[model samples]
Target: MALNETHDEYEQQDLKRNLSNRHLQLIAIGGAIGTGLFMGSGKTISLAGPSIVFIYMIIGCALFLVMRALGELLLSNLQYKSFIDFATDLIGPWAGYFVGWTYWLCWITVGIADLAAINNYLMFFNDGIAFTPVEGAMISIAAILFIMGLNLVTVKLFGEMEFWFAMIKIIAIVVLIAVGIWMVVTGFTNESGAVASFSNIWSHNGMFPQGWGGFLAGFQIAIFAFVGVELVGTTAAETKDPKINLPKAVNSIPIRIIIFYVLALLIVMSVTPWDQINPKVSPFVNLFSQAGIAAAAIIMNLVVLSSVMSSMNSGVFSTSRMLFGLAKEHQAPQALGKLSKASVPANGLYLSSVALLAGAALQYFVPDTVRAFTLATTLSTILFICVWVMIMISYMRYRKLRPELHEQSTFKLPGGVFTCWLVILFFIGTIYIMSLETDTFEALKVSPIWFIILIIGYFGFYKPRLKAVVDSKI
Candidate 1:
């Protein structure tokens, strides 16, 4: 191995941070806005009642704080390509292995869920169309291939694709929110709710329509809305002008998504009332239908189509990077770090796609109308929270060990170390709340199995890894 500063077995840092401002901007939005919000809003609001507003706000706040911690760390040290890399370098190899793999799993599961959503959406217009699990699996794998192709062509092309995709989602949400507000102002009346107003929220079950019981229940559903928030940090390695733009993208996006989720859901609930909104029907579609637009379903299908694909694209991109980071540290297969001339980790992209092929198989062999998005999403949020927790812990140690780097930071998490501890506690409480949710509880019960494996793997292999790495260096 060349002992030159930049070269190890390969030029570990050969991949340049070439992504521009627009790419980072859209990529940030691409991660946060998904079709789930468009389609799942009605169901979540109905289940949690008018209290769903606070559900979005609360999770949004906690998630923003989590992003704050991430922003501070990424800005202070732009050498770290992604959050997982930061965890590995700061926390140790065990964390690198655990965070990288779990994060990849998180995206793989999300990709499958989005694939299922896409196929189901297609079914809406094709009334007689039938899809077996086999067909669904094929569609999902095909979607993965499409995303891999985009990523492999050029990161910018993938960013451009996401840029337009996020634009569609952004425009759709803005239009929906505006029309919803207009409906409220004009006193729009619907079959489900005679005269819509702020009172529509209270007319049925009130703000806590299901009582405090429902508000608490809303937490379970609300957590999933924060799924892609950390994705903002994933682009750090490729992000051009990361110190300046990365922070701005991370800080501004969470606020924008928060407003979109809370205000939009509140308006939708106000227009339709909690009881009238059907999660299955999609509130976006109902918004158009209630507005008497003949093409509401058409427009919503188009918006959600873009949204789902953008999310899948992001899942492919982020998970590949995590795998790439793992490989760099020798915590995973070195093959994962190999970059193609396009600067994409072609191996991880294709390998993760292979994992997603399992989805196609599952869909073909035994596709259920429900793959249990609620629970799977809940499990993901919990796992994602753990990654965020690790970020704070890693950052905490960084502050303790590298006080000199704090001055280099253009972006720092507001309030310093105390907030890190607070955020960690917030995560712990989130897990407690997960147990409170019956749907999420099943996931919580099973989640420990993953951590147990992590523990076993740590004791079993990680120690030897450090020795092997050192001996190799010698």
Candidate 2:
């Protein structure tokens, strides 16, 4: 399709480019920093030891390439609203259908996990007030509604909320890094008698303390931390200047990985040996509490709460947009494509919110909420891998079919098609790593059922209607 032709077609639709450069930047930042890093890192460290650092770095590098490919595609065709759009145009409508709904399901699961996380965080300040899982589920529903309300207001309001949310996360990481450095430089000792020192990283049974199996286990959870990084690509339709702001957001992935993941992990391990880091509590809170700073631990908890909220907020926004995009392409009900007078996809937003709320109710059914949440998270990560792999495949196809566009594009992905293939291999390896663990392997076993359902729905429902519409148009 011609660029102008596609542009004109979407111009008739109502979604506006209201998100500013600052919003785009912060959204990208928020996507990179997830609560998994705060809450899940401890488990990863215990499993992989200090080698978790390399796992994060390796995943970050591979995902950066995924973002680069996504960025190149979005910029290459301004008419394309998001990756889902280009996937359909470049690949096939089946590609769009599968990716769009899978992404929506991905965020729904993430939102469910975040709601459970937020409830657990709130109990920290409950002050002996007993809160049951049902009550937590109620609060989770309320929080989802509140975020949905914000999204219904205006895109600008959504952006503003994200900006502040991202800001809090940034400040929290910076504070943690600074305090960790101080403890290391001053040789501060923890209650456990683990003296602060950079040598702590390697001194405690070497870097790969748990051997290759443990290192492989780290990839399962570490990949979840990077789930939202591709969120920036979803905002392509609403971003002010895709060429400038989008590239800036995509290119900054490395710097974020270095500061947020690598340096943060290095300092945490330095202050407290990897072996001593509690697998249950957050390393951030643990480090401060071990140093006799109760106030800082409270602050870190609050920061973690904010991070979880930010992630859920982004989840709601992206999933709703995916539904809206699906509706526009006739992959979903026409009702979902309708935008309110405020230029928001109010229907799609509500639909996604309802799905998320249903997920919240899982707390009441599952006997062990933590285990259920872990399974949900693993399932979401697997679906995300599918989405990222689709993007890579789409980019490869874009290059082969439209080499002229690739040649003319100002921002070309380095390593081109070769890098795309490498990233695919990296994701496959991560999935293989996930399969080695029992919990994650269970999630992998259950995940394919979702795709099977999607396949059945496509042929049973969508294919006949789509064919009829095409025949009429022709």
Candidate 3:
């Protein structure tokens, strides 16, 4: 069955359900673990010291609540292609329109940011064989084409590629953990006379080494790490046996966080004192290099490279699917609703690629746009939190008006409406935390411009057109 196909479509125009349990599981894992763990963990550890472990757990738990709400909403009605669908049916058409376009832009900006990161990661191999600016741009273009090619082929190819990309990340972390355990148990000492041991976690100035200020500072970076955790919610339409697969994916989030995030960080700190970790360097790379692994830099660079590529791949798939959903609701241009023979949203993919192409051009021509790109990513993070809040809002409406549905739901969100409020408050608090940082604060000031644009577009454009569509049916 296709994602949004109805008997009215004659089975010719719908997203085919080619994704299996395997795809969903790995997609969930890939969404939960991002390149941030590899590239940004050092800064987080340096900021909060050993207490960073608790920070990840706290953020993980909050997002798991958000996922649980999303899972229950998705399973309640299989016709709900994504949260956008339910947001329309339960909240209002306005909610759907806002979330659909906002989510689409979220992925677009994140995709652009990923492209920039890819270019930098490629430059890491700039040894004797230096990559000229032209060569670097070519590499970035090739990467974009490669990911876009996978998306244009089949959804399964995207899933398979993500499975392997995620597998590499998992393997890298597992290897790091295993090696760290060996070093700790054997009391391996480094050149700095620091011995590897579990005691290293708190032995240095204790777990809350930097106190509450530093602990709060960690949230500013750590929240972005979990940006894509709700990504599995987007695949509900194409998932085979979503009831089994979706819950399994959502339920495993806590365990994945403990293993991939909490445990992985614990191992990194155990092997090296938190204070000694370099904020500018990757802890994963540093850990391997410390363990006497000569190819550690090469190996970790490849892993991070693949990690960014995986994100771009997922971004392409997500943005395209979002356009498809929007078109089905008549909120977007009809052309975007068209599907390829492979059941992929070709036009949506093309449009997203064009946006990314613009991003590449910016990188090549402007060259001093890191601040602009950072602002874009920060705004993306703010929009993601908005989407999550909308999901929770939709869930609350579902319980209020569709009480019978809630009664019949087997996989109910624990604490129900109360949990919804708690998650919403947590996100509001996160936005406040963002304001405390100079860089993120700038993004916050700029974010309202996006909503202002959305408001004008909705009233000035989409609403009247939607009204006409409804009037024509009468």
As a whole number from 0 to 100, the lDDT of residue 124 in candidate 2 is: 63
Give one digit per residue, the lDDT tens place, for model 1 in 106-191: 88777776776777676767662757666777777788788878888877787789889988888888888888888889998886
C-alpha lDDT of residue 82 in model 1: 78
Off by over 4 Å in 2: 1-11, 127-130
Give the per-residue lDDT of model 2 (tens digit) for 1-474.
542344345448757899999999999999999978987898899999999999999999999999989998999989898767999999999999999999999999999878767776676688625367688778878888888988899888889999999999999999999999999999999988889999999998899999998998988888899999999998888888889999999999999999999999999999999999988677988888888997998899899998998998899899889988987777887778777888888898999899987766876665254566678789999999999999999999999899999998987899998999899998898888888899999999999899999999899988986786676566
Model 1, runs deviating above 4 Å: 1-7, 128-130, 459-462
lDDT of 3 by residue, 195-276 (tens): 9999999999999999987888788667767877888999888889999999999999999999999999999999999998
TM per candidate = 0.93, 0.96, 0.93
Candidate No. with top TM-score: 2
The list of candidate 3 runs beyond 4 A from truth reads 1-12, 128-137, 361-376
Please tell me which model should have the higher lDDT, number 1 or number 3.
3
With a 3 Å backbone cut-off (N, CA, C), the pairs that clash in candidate 1 are 43-279, 133-363, 133-364, 134-364, 137-360, 205-209
Q: How does candidate 2 fare on TM-score?
A: 0.96
Scored against the true structure, residue 78 in model 2 reaches a CA lDDT of 94
